[model samples]
Target: MTHDLVIRGGTIVDGTGAAPYDGDVAIDGTEIVAVGNVSSNGKREIDATGHIVTPGFIDGHTHLDAQIAWDPMVTPSTQHGVTTVLLGNCGVTFAPCKPEHREKLAGMMETVEDIPKHAIMSGLSWDWDQYGDYLDYIEKSKPAVNVVGLVGHCAIRYYVMGDRAVDELASDEEIEQMAQLVDNAVKAGAIGFSTSRVEGHRIPDGRPVPGTFSSEEELCRFAEIVRDNGGGLMQTVL
Candidate 1:
């Protein structure tokens, strides 16, 4: 039977630690129907000779949050064959924020990642306030590749403590609130929580990012939330 499409004459490295082999890949509609020297003719054919085909790569850590706002194609990453990316690394994301504090997150990202503030401001609509809402926005943006996000502790701290987050330790009540927010974000769509402890991760104003000063107890409390929520990843840039 004929296939919808065929990629002919390529070295296939399936990424399963298997050895590479010269083969043809046949596709029917969107699914790969066969591989390895398929003899079937196809409606469309690509001469993949002299090329190696492999699975798309995944980037474990990325600061694509601000960049994704402007570039949904998630360029450079996509150009390099990275089809999946994790965003909101190093505790800088724009979600679970008050309308008044939108710029705060932007400034932190701008400072820590060197992303232009104006690009973030003009890129996309800041129409989300909850972590889930931001994920929904990502879905609607129709990025070229899959994206999983981590709820950033910097934005969460700023959301919970306002200006006090920069220098003040979280009170017990505040910690509980932040933990609950993390739980909410995880349930909403976040794959995990992220924070930064490195001195270099400063906000636009020269102060360390919020959560940088958090005590170990505070961090454990947040970790406990991830544990209690069944299971979710925790990312840090220390």
Candidate 2:
């Protein structure tokens, strides 16, 4: 039986905390079939004589929420061998938005992330209104690598409170609603929830992001939701 592809004579770093070793890797179809000295010849062969072969990297923090709208390849990350990227970081995302609030959210992202608003506005279809719908849109975008998303607190707060999300503390009822939204997002396949408290993370108007001033109770409620949902990550940029 012949293999589909073989990479020969490379230092393999398996990323398992195992020691690196010089070996050959054989691939049959999409699955890696074998490693080490493989006697079988492959349909395609690559001479990786002095190179290092390892699993693709996973970037834990990224702001590709807007960029991915236009560029499915996601640029430099893919070029550098990052196979997975976590988006919606620094508590900024574009989802759960109303038609009327589209520009507001886009402008917020533009201000905080420095991604051009025109590109975001023009490139994306804007067909989604929920976290799951956004995921579906991304799935159809055929990204070059795997994309994991987090529910951004900024977007969620803005969606639920409009202008008040910027300055006023959320009410008890509002906190409950926000908690439910976070729960829904996690169930909808969001890898986690993200928020920012760093003073540097602010919109162009000099106001901090929506979730920056959340009370401890609000934060804990969100954490409880994450814990109850089996397990998930929480990203905070402070």
TM-scores for every candidate against the unseen true structure: 0.94, 0.96
Please give the RMSD of candidate 2 to the true structure: 1.1
What number of clashing residue pairs does each candidate have, in the order they appear?
A: 0, 0
Estimate every model's Cα lDDT from 0 to 1: 0.88, 0.88
lDDT (C-alpha) at residue 133 in model 1? 93
Clashing pairs in 2: none
Candidate number achieving the greatest TM-score relative to the actual structure: 2
| Shift in Å, residue 209, candidate 2 | 0.9
Error of 1 at 84 (Å): 0.7
Report the C-alpha lDDT of model 2 over 1-238, residue by residue, as the tens digit: 7999999999999999999999999999889999999889999999999999998999998889877767899998999989999998888888878787788778888888888888888888889888999999999989999999999898889888888998989999999988888988899999888899987778768888788988989888998888899878987788
Question: Could you report the Cα RMSD, in angstroms, for every candidate shown?
Answer: 1.5, 1.1
lDDT by residue (tens digit), candidate 1, 52-82: 9777899999988867766889989999989
